[model samples]
Target: MEAFVQSKREDTAKEPSLFLLPEWMEADKRLTAGFTGRGGGVSAEPWTGLNIGLHVGDDEEAVILNRKRVTEALGWPFEAWTCTEQVHGSRVAQVTLAERGKGRERMDDTIAGCDALMTDVPGVLLTSFYADCVPLYFYAPEAGAVALAHAGWRGTVGGIAARTAEAMASAYGVRPDQILAAIGPSIGDCCYEVDGLVVTEVDRVMDELKLPEGERESCMQRKKNGKASLNLKELNRQIMIKAGILPSRIELTTWCTGCRTDLFYSYRVEGGKTGRMASWIGLQER
Candidate 1:
């Protein structure tokens, strides 16, 4: 139930410490997950410092070194890290030991083709990159299973988080109640504005939009103007609740990438010119 926050230091000479969720607080022996803020790593300038997204135009060697730093910070072997190409779709990939190093071989690996990844194998780090889009992490200690998902507005409306949870349950026998979720840093409600298309898609997936007593009309009315402010974090939280996870088990980082330009990357802030931050999870080998 405790939370830890690590701020980035201006100097790189200090040992890079990736944020971590305390094991005692989490009460889960088999799972570990955290979001990597913009600090750490070797990329410079636009992709300066710990930029993990390979396709973001950073030098290949810098990106490789950044990944190595991240893996080392997490106490994971460099070769055990697994990430996919995220297409903002609802597809989820199942990872096994045999599949290790499949996605990291080259930037063009199939990992980018899948938006979500799940695995029960220890030492296999499952990761997804993001800027403003929400990154969802799931862990089922009893089943020794974990998953990472990339949820943009489209994927959110498509119920990607819920689908990933269901997949973990079906594939690994993880009970929804036993699953612990961490909704990582992303664009918060303060900055996320959408159009009618997004609202309609959200309504289609969510049973009813429950607004504050006097805010119902205003909430729906904004959609008609072709632009409406949406709370993506809250929206995804609702999706998790509907999937049967308890509200208490979910932890949300209030840091908004769009708001904190210096600490994290944001597509909204940089306008397609920004690098990406990463959220990663894996089980340590016994």
Candidate 2:
């Protein structure tokens, strides 16, 4: 079954039209986690609707309003919303109460120099934006912790998934076995083609993981023309498994952002000028 369930609504602008983690993963109601879609917002043109990215050339006011709309739909406080300036690096920042709402309204206010954010502190709704790059989620409910990572090819090769798990274990004593990780919607192997430098980095990651030939072939397939189609979502899943998280504990989404442009924003297909969706995971305060 798909981990991310799309909530149906009549008008996206009037209600929350986003993908949600099913109840099985959030049975306690203590955790609120999911990814946003490209509907139910006020952005125009290439950004279309619900572009929740401040750095994507969308109107700043529209991006802020769209973000507020998302929080409102999630029944989370707008003031609790937090974000980062994703540089596609593997740095993970530990968010605290003081950092809550840091970048809710302006890009300048965003937590700088990080591609990932985690928190054991409740009420800090950790979020990161995405167009085609992968969005990774980590939840250690036992320690009241959760994390969100933006893994482009660079971050993936850098082992951001393992880094995030290590951060949780160090800061909150949350073991990797106890972590529930999820790879959210992004461009699937069916649509993402790469070559040259991109291929070289991926090759290195495969070697580091010591993945078997079969597994490596599935993660990235070489085309007849020498280019390769990369499966970033699967690659991240393997990273989590290698980090000691049980394979059964990780949730992988099959929703390909590139194939579902009507419901998602695809940087490659959308001609580079596109909006961004958001991945959020946080523990609401009791």
Name the Cα RMSD for model 2: 1.1
Which regions of candidate 2 fall more than 4 Å away from where they truly are? none
What is the lDDT of every predicted structure here? Answer: 0.77, 0.91
RMSD of each: 2.9, 1.1
Query: Best-fitting candidate, measured by TM-score?
Result: 2
Clashing pairs in 1: 84-111, 84-112, 85-111, 85-112
Instruction: List model 2 lDDT by residue over 1-286, tens digit each.
Output: 8989999877766664689887534575878889999988899997989899888888998888888888988888899999999998999999988899988898899999999999988788999999999999998878888999999999998999999999999999999999988999999999999999999999998999999999998899998998999999999999999999999999899999999999999999989999999999888778
Top of the candidates by lDDT: 2
Question: Residue by residue across 55-82, what tens digits does model 1's lDDT show?
Answer: 8888888877777877776667878878
TM-score of 1: 0.89
